[model samples]
Target chain A: MITIFGKPLLLLYGQLTLGLINGAFYALLSLGLAVIFGLLNIINFAHGALFMLGGFVAWALLEYLDIGYWPALVLAPLIVGVFGVVMEKTLINRLYKLDHLYGLLLTFGCALIIEGLARNEFGSSGVPYPIPDELRGPLDLGFMMLPAYRAWVVVAAAGVCLATWLVIEKTRIGSTLRAATENAPLVQAFGVNVPRLITLTYGAGVALAAFAGVLAAPIYSVNPNMGANFIITVFAVVVIGGMGSILGSIVTGFGLGILEGLTKVYYPQASATVVFMVMVIVLLARPAGLFGKA
Target chain B: MPMSRRALLATAAATALPVRPARAEKPTLKIGVLTDLSGPYKDLAGPGAVDAARMAVEESGLAAKGINIEVLSANHQNKADVGASVAREWYDRDGVDIILEVANSGVALAVAGVTKEKNKVYINSGAATSDLTGAQCNANTIHWVYDTYMLAHSTGAAMVKTGGDSWFLIVADYAFGHALQRDSTDFVQKAGGTVLGAVRYPFPSTTDFSSFLVQGQASGAKVLGLASAGTDVINLIKQAHEFGIKMRIAGLLIFLTDVHSLGLEVSQGLTLTESFYWDLNADTRRFADKFARRQPGRRPTMVHAGVYSSGLHYLKTVGDMGLAQARADGAATVARMKATPTSDDCFGPGSIRADGRKLCPAYLFEVKKPSESKGPWDYYKLLATTPADEAFRPLSASACPLVKA
Candidate 1:
């Protein structure tokens, strides 16, 4: 019976719950971007395409290999991760010394090629991926019926995000990786295989993106262009969270998603622009982003 | 690849007669085909739309009349400014006699404005805004194929007739979505159905629609009317399936390509409307067979069929009027097009109204169950077919200035 700003209270609760579910994806995706940019200093523009590749790989695995969601969740990322490593070794490794724009351009070209190939293989109308049986139904969560898959998305994404943060911020290897980003030659002098670390870091970042893609495959219409839809928004999330800041991206991703959800409820017309609008304000207020170090 | 497809059309067309225009309109009749070549709509109205126009030119038999008919195509990329600039360039620089396809509603409307200013013919098959035939209607432009009014009246009335007494609309926030929702609301309300509420989501960006779906479920609306198109509709259906929300989901303006993407399982039992379907009848089948050969593994949607039919009618008018006059005066050419009844391999025989609106039969189809589909593109099972006279908006209701009270 209660109303908030002329809308029902139940509506706000329901939108907030749904917002958290969507925030899981933004958090998951931006975390990967944060890790890749934070450690490698390569603005991986192909991240979106790679994310799309992840969903396709899951679809392909299920379609061709009869690998269900459970295994493809593990296998798709592994396959896409290895491809990322190969890309790093062959092409991306060549651009470490160049300006950041070169890395961005190369990756952008990579995104186009990858998207084109996927489009050629699978037409843009998008193929459907079934929700896993375990998470198929909705939970009658009093105020609203929440899909179990959505609940799973939020939990799984949060777990992975926390694990990634712990590994990057708390562990010895993560500390060494961070050291390498600060001064690569100095980290190499300390005998900690810096090039291999960079390669692995890119692989891990790509793996995280693929993982999000796997989580998203069941939710979004599994298509080549699906990743392109979110990549720019995810990039906005990363910038708002403080680019290259792991905690910043993870926190800001969820915050912006909930903000976007509320925008959908209040001013649906401005829902699309709400995130970018926040980005402009945040950047003006704090150029380094919400959590980035100046 | 193209040779084989052309061979297929050539072999088939050898038996039929082209509506021979008595004389040449101009030495060269260059028809520009502008559409969304590389965006979300590319599958429905991109390259396929251009191919449809090409077929129309070829089938019009304008070539055999020693009239050099050239079809030039460009991708608007779903941008309004880009489409307007392209229209200006095509008319002013390339000497294009008329433009066809003009796919996205926003882009098509933008190009419509330019077409009026430049005094060039524009036949639209892609956009759904009835405003083209309503407020924005112009002598220089012909609103072809289907519009939001027909889609809403057909699908909305169908759903309401089937005991969907309460409705909730999940709309894409844009002019097209707004028009569809507005028109659909009219039909729903007129048919004694109450609209519970509606949600407008930012389009081409807010793909995850679970939030909106939850709101729809909580509202207790019997039917969830999706006043959005393309991937947005597909995403809503797919997610609604996952959530197992039992509200009847009705997609107002679903293309065959959209049904193809969603597959029979997720999209099954959804009643929708279309002006053209490749499997409608022998005429469409024969024409679609050649069109499928050109696109390869793809069936033509209504937009493509509209392009084919509209192109044929335009070229025929130009042929009748002569090149100099048709090219010099777009309004006269459009008047001539309206004066003649349209007969094509697609929509068969139809007539154009004074407001530059093309009238034809509209079909209501249910997406067949996976078990019912015989093969690929065997997606629709016809529920009903409205005759040409009743399929579109009546002339009395039109808001075009050309229409008298």
Candidate 2:
């Protein structure tokens, strides 16, 4: 093994890779939050709950319907996306005209109800979802052995983030979305159907969270509180990256995740609180965030 | 949000309507099983514990003596604040005579103070921290079953003797985990083993232990010690298996349910210690058979057995003296319980110490291999049993003010 600064390079490599994997989840979750906030101007406090719903739905599909991972990967997000549409049409639509705090409160209530229901059904003990057979063993990367599934998570999450950034930053529909965010009335006068677009945008943002949940099911045990655990750190990530910029959220999520991994190696006690510390620092320095246009 | 006039009228009507028969003549003995009904320790101490308590009351023949025994239960959700509030409510408004089966140590510690303040009894079965008897000891609380000291003494010493020395600890960042790590580390050192390092992950929220496992592997320790319980144990073991880490893993605080969750494939060969096991002896099996009748597929965990042992002993104490007299003074009733020896089919025979800790022998159990399984719930094979006196902390070492010089 290569030695770096009197420590084995494989050990540092393993930690950094794990950090990147954790960052990938943060990036996907935060990107969705940014997209929703960009158009709706309301923070999706239930984003984490929706993510948990995604994993549960995937687990249910595998358990009840005998649908395997491949099908669940595609179907889970769609099912959650539809649930998001229904939530937006029914409860969230009514709160858009009120204070943003109302939207936050409503979503927070939705999260609690969802979590409580899941807890009642599943209990707090997490049920295991096996890693797919193909991704079961370790990949012998000459210097270090990386678990195949973890490698897939890092690559898959990065690919999803990149694709999402491309779709929003390029193409005509993406331009329409940006223009609507700037001036909804102007886009409406152009026969753009801004309301329908808003509903779909919210649905799409929620779909991203659900997708991340499906990806996480095999790695983390499927449980009710899983979303609640990650959501707070992700909120810190969104704040550090700013609420309105998708690219900023993606970059900040991964950066903080790696930083957290490094903290675990050098100073293990601060790993949990490190993300929030970075958030505080970022807020103090750049009131609007790293990439947010102030 | 003022109450509607209609709601005020209804409240007034309800308050004016109810008057029951005199409670002084036939007072009810209410036993509240405050536990984690939905959280991590649920399977270990939730509905199963309630069943154990009910069975104790049923088998005690207290009904023949006109002692109206009532059992109430609630989910603490593993939060200390929530547990304290529920315990407060149970004592103040509900008239719950005693509270038992607090599983999480943090929750148990929080509720212990409340029970002491309210002059009610608490019998802890699930919490692992010995401080419940040592520093946090009170007249109103009795720590039944097992504690971290017993587990560390039994398992850590066993592992070290088996040549699984040089240690790396992955501890849950909480009170119980800290106690387990501290107590077990002392045992490891006493056994002439060295501890390389330890990593503490946030409790409850940490799902992935891959990075932690990597750190453990790099520590170059022969044994990896897990100072956590419930799902955290299951996840850590599963991830370690996935990583193909060959180091002997010392499970500091685990239950049969955690093994069941991991399945024999992953949990096989794990050695842990417990105060009771269903298949340990004939007496344990007899109680286990009856318990299985209610909770069909699952076996009685040590904590569930503790509930029955403590519950049976508590009711016998209540039945000897009238419920009205016992209900008047919680500390006096606990003193009477301490005066009597603890005996039940589950935990054979033991005695409650002056510090409110029930002294019982702890058995070391090695998880059975998959091929060794004869049928369902056939999990463990007994390795060795640590005698009662040697298993727990000495009274001289206890910091409890209740322990007179």
Candidate No. with top DockQ: 1
Residue-level lDDT tens digits of model 1 in B126-201: 8999989888889888988899999998888988888998999999888888998899999999999999999888
Q: What is candidate 2's local distance difference test score?
A: 0.89
Q: Candidate 1 residues A119-176, lDDT tens each?
A: 7677777887888888877788888778888899999999999999999889999999
The two-chain DockQ for each candidate, comma-separated, is: 0.60, 0.57
Models, CA RMSD each: 7.3, 3.7
lDDT of 2 at A132: 83
Candidate 1's displacement at residue A162, Å, is 2.2
lDDT of 2 at A279: 81
Docking class of 2: medium
Evaluate model 1: give its lDDT. Answer: 0.89
How does chain A of candidate 1 score by TM-score against the true chain A? 0.99
Q: lDDT per prediction?
A: 0.89, 0.89
User: In candidate 1, which residue pairs get closer than 3 Å at backbone N, Cα or C atoms, i.e. clash?
Assistant: B25-B322, B25-B323, B26-B323
